[model samples]
Target: MTQAPPELPLHMRRDHFDPVAELAEVRESEGVRRVTSTFGMPAWLVARHDDVRDVLADATRFSNASQLAFSLPDDPRSAEEKRKALAGQMLATDPPDHTRLRRFLTPEFTVRRMRRLEPRIVEIVDQHLDAMEAAGSPADLVPSFALPIPSLVICELLGVPYADRDEFQHRTARQLDLSIPMPERIALQREGRAYMEKLVAGAKADPGEDMLGMLVREHGADGLSTAEAQDGAAEITDDELAGLASLLLVAGHETTSNMLGLGTLALLRHPDQLALVRDDPDAIVPAVEELMRWLSIVHTGVARTTTQDVEIAGQHIPKGELVLCALPSANRDPSFIDDPDTLDVRRGSMGHIAFGHGVHHCLGAPLARMEMRIAFPALLKRFPDLASALPFDEIPFRAYHFIYGLHSLPVTW
Candidate 1:
């Protein structure tokens, strides 16, 4: 078969985008196209929701445990120097190991527990607004607002000292983030490893009621020894502890920050939905979910690898190959969503892959939902007429790419 095109949709690179036209082209292209990533050891890209679902639901056929899923090396030497330090954590592991690790974290993220956190979330939202008002109008919503709010909240839960939150957020942003420059990301990962070791030691010696403390008690939350390594280890390794913290911090802040910027921009364009939320506080949570689907903040799919040769949608995928899940495609799949391109607050977002699905679904999803439910309403209520200060074309975006995010959203009331 002839090689397919390598060009990804141009709009995919932007922070704020409506890829309806682009996605339609992708849908047609994927049906016949043999897409490939420029990244080493190329694999076919699956852009249709059904193809993605087939890949996701059949983990045995399409294994995520393959190092190629994330494009990392599996060498024991690199692993000892780099790989073993963080490999086999929940996000990186498959099946039984993934299952076991996720078990320890399930309860902390339940919607019920998340509901109880709404009050605390409200205070956090309000505090950011309060600070914004005092600082003056037309504040950039990132550092002053969007980013710091969730950073602090997760730190509080993890028992990371307020003093260390800045560093933790910096390091967490690096390792989980694929958008940054490679050298910087590698350096940040190293910094994260050193920081987490100290934090884990602190939690080990003096456990608190926080999640890390609880991890110490339940998962042993202590340093790993040779005996523990033989058993796949636990309460935490330098990598596991750092990885968990990294996952939570990124999930907690990045999505919310994107939603705050992107969702706010979308809401402004959709007057009816914005009016509905402005009229009723109870509408915030579900509204947040809808916005998540609409924004699809993650923008791309989860990555998986083929464990065996399999025919999906009549297309053969060979063993030991990589697959990008195309999550944004799933959220807008015509089979599942009617008028998928249209933003509708009334639509059900429960099935949206905005937080992904199955075993590797987002653990901090509930907390993220709660944060937005509280944050959006309080933002509109306080400012009442917050408006972007810069032209839509000129608003700032991160120098780094991959993540669809605005670097600075200057808005004035």
Candidate 2:
């Protein structure tokens, strides 16, 4: 007779959501197998690095086209609408459609194009630290620095007004909660999409140099009718456009913010690494990689559905089943990363799953890395004795969410 795996806590139910010891147990466990959850969803948790990479690289059998499977909505009505609405967005499609949707923005987000934001990113980092200094030595860095810096940078790129950020930033946490009722989640998604619709409409009527405006001017409506065009513009429907904008805002803000906060927490916990970077800010470049690897903020990669039946690592996934790539587990794979648990700055993490793998990899990765490369060193250099305001465990870490992070990284120098 065998005992079943323990159930996840309500507060920690987000998939790939982090709980170190538990994750390690599942990650290091043998074979790709079925994990029946209290949520009633039967999922195949791919814990090995090679297996995760295999699943991600082979998309014919597994399609991003089915974003419906990825959605974990607590409400039926909103879930159905959201699941239906996003089918038009890039993340929701496979092949030809995904390629078309992702292609338009790829060139702009390239390494070269992202380089232009470095100066601005650095300036933003300095500004945040300066603001932190002015307020008080011990201040909550999460909102003041971590949140605003990336939020501001992404908003600027999207042509969203700086003034409007406060509202979006305020709503980001609640909107991102997977535990929130499906109706609430659906409403939040609609509000975000609606906001982006207005923004895109404004950009079309009167152009700007931002990504949204460029997208409108450059990519004429691919298949949408005048009615749909009235809805928004170009290759995507209004709902799709809204989904893209909402995704960009949420992705741009949360992931980078968590990396910054959690990365900082990792450093504070490891003094030797802290001293290494404090002496030479240049070390922040590789240091950020190790941080990404060690922090591995996203619990699971994007939810993918099996477009067709597939056998990976000798484990058969029947057609239409849910197969999710685990980011944290992959990053810590022993085959690729030596001493996968230890945080080694010099370790070659170029292939790390921190951003992800294949075409659907994070478009904003370069920007996030740039922000961190600038932000971390600046924070350490500015505050030599930076210390947490509350007891480490007392600080509010994000619970029950895919993006593992702290709610407010309170600190003082």
Candidate 3:
């Protein structure tokens, strides 16, 4: 018999545009509070902005490598299998190992590289807008607009064939949905790994100019030498390559797509902000930042394990305890910004921890920002009269998933 699904932790819970009141209360009254994690493990929820940043910044005191210990109660994978599963997953590893992997991929995500891709991104956004307009109004923006733009962008970037997007997207969506049974989610994860491994093998055979091929050409076994190996040059293994690609593919699209869907709904709710984002080109950059801050989409940064006894916000946490940074709480902490609950596009949300902080900051942040900067204004420009088809309270929010977003956003112009 299978075990029951775990409850969604308080830190992950949200109420429409804001985090639940309880999370705010905790951030106000106690900067650090012990809570039961989704996996039923007792974890410390770091609620203040400063505390969360400090936790994320100090990799020595807080180790991400031990986070894997909080896996499903009935997971049957062997120790080696589990280790391989996390091989190149930067989010699952600490420094030195993570440092090596990130070095290989950092050049591809720089500002100059994103600038080079800007024209193509613009074309892709326009193409989707054309399709949405051609299909007429009353379309669900989730699939028609929000999902496909970033999905195609990441596919081309990673060298994954866009035709296979449906399968992988379904797998990833299910993989992150906490409502799904643990066993089924694990099965989906395995399936996604197998699918990516084949693509990794193809990239190894005849490398293309995309990121996977770049890794295969420069960091694969064929490219490194014994002398270089001694000098600390690392060759990315097949499992590692697959793991990294899978992570990029999922993150590259999911977070941005959700932002598009949810952000559109947010703008629709506040017409004045909507008008600002749509009419003023200068307003979009800061507007995107504000949206990301308000959304705080990912429930919490990856759960961290305490390497030594640590005191945060005057609360003592013993070594080997699981600690989570409540990102929504941190972003919404009144001390972090003025009028934390209100959505004001004019307020530049510069220091928000939306894409996370410290070493584990989202590698694809530049790409995500570029996509939003280009896509949001272009989308508003294309559909000047865009309005949500559903009522405010009727919107279907994907609350149980690791990422907060809309399941579907029906709209008309």
Candidate 4:
């Protein structure tokens, strides 16, 4: 008779800001431990900061492209169809292919580009702040302020119509919710792709000054020159463009919006730290970094599979085995920082892997940082006495989603 695998601890979002207590225990005793993934697959969960960085940094040894059937056990889509749906997501590719795709898109997200958008970002933040103020005290911060700034900025960047935000936002939320069945999530993915396909078609017909138009103009049928084709520019296809666009549209807004909502709640809870960020102009940048490290809103780093047998923190993980990093655990690991669990706005928190580590590190770090740095202080200064409208315990956190965040943050001045 064979022995059954041990039951794994739940790894979904938490109702509170803290990571599950079990992760802290595992990090201390067994930095790399075998656990069952939410998808029902066996995986090695790396918790310590150093070990997590090692796994993420070594792309050759840990392949991001290794297809783990994270889909529901009853998923109706075939493997090939699923693969096609995930094809152009930068997070799903590795090395040469990843490098190629990133090269084309990176120029658009550089610090210089993000700086150019900063004035407009500040304007958008103020506009939302204006709306929140007009509504009087006791407003739901998520919809009133948190969601709109990033949503509008990304819409302008991608040339996506702001009027269509609700549809895409709904689809993104459902798709990231772990409780949503695989079949339903797949349907959402298809719907998002169809929407992007229509947008890509429009961009190809008459290119605008947005990212989509730039992509179509540089890589589309009418765009690529013979020399450009020789350099692999023509390799991009309409389907691939749609996939890429959809990924950007979803990722650009969802992650930042959640950060804005969750970060606000965090600062409200830590009044001293909130005062530091609100009162000191110099503290704003480092405060954003510390908040990212402290919150680790993206609960899991992208999952990878071992390319060969590997030893991580004394555990022998076999070739092709699934591997995941518990980001919240790593960010809060005592070895990563002094008083790791405390929210300190003054600390630089520069080395934390909140944006992740190595090649797949977040491309939009500059943009996200600018948004947070601008939005937090502005909201704080605008309403100096902002406080939670509901009891902290009563405020619902998004416990079912892969990206941890608040469902809504009710606040009043």
Residue-level lDDT tens digits of model 2 in 1-413 = 43353345322343322445555566666546576432447777777788888788776877776756554535555655655456446666667666766776787788998888788888888888878888887788888888899988989898888799877776676776655554665677667667777887787778688887787777745457434433333365545555667778888888999988888877888888888877876677788888887777876665677877788677778888777776777787778777887887755356888787877788888888888888887888899898888876587877645578888888889
> Whose lDDT is higher: candidate 3's or candidate 4's?
3
Stretches of candidate 4 above 4 Å error?
A: 1-9, 13-15, 68-72, 222-235
Per-residue accuracy of model 1 over 232-282 as CA lDDT, tens digit each: 554545456656765565566667777777777777678788877777867
Ranking by TM-score: 3, 4, 2, 1
**Each candidate's lDDT (Cα)?**
0.67, 0.73, 0.89, 0.84
lDDT, candidate 4, residue 138?
89
Poorest 10 consecutive residues of model 1 by lDDT? 2-11
Best by TM-score: 3
Residue 104 accuracy (lDDT) in model 3: 81
As for lDDT, the candidate ahead, 2 or 3, is 3
Candidate 3: clashing pairs of residues: none
Question: Per-residue lDDT of 1-413 in model 3, one digit per residue for the tens?
Answer: 75575667898888888899999989999788889987888999999999999999999999998887666687978887787777678898888777887888999999999999999999999999999999898899999989999999999999999999889889888888888887788899899899999999999998999999999998888544333433456787777788899899889767999999999999999999999999998999999999999888988988999999999999999999999999988998888898899888899666999999989999999999999999999989999999999988999999888899999999999
Candidate 2 Cα outliers beyond 4 Å, as residue runs: 1-19, 36-39, 67-84, 226-238
Query: In model 4, how large is the Cα lDDT of residue 44?
Result: 86
Query: How well does model 2 score by local distance difference test?
Result: 0.73
Model 1, backbone clash pairs (residues 3+ apart or across chains), number: 7
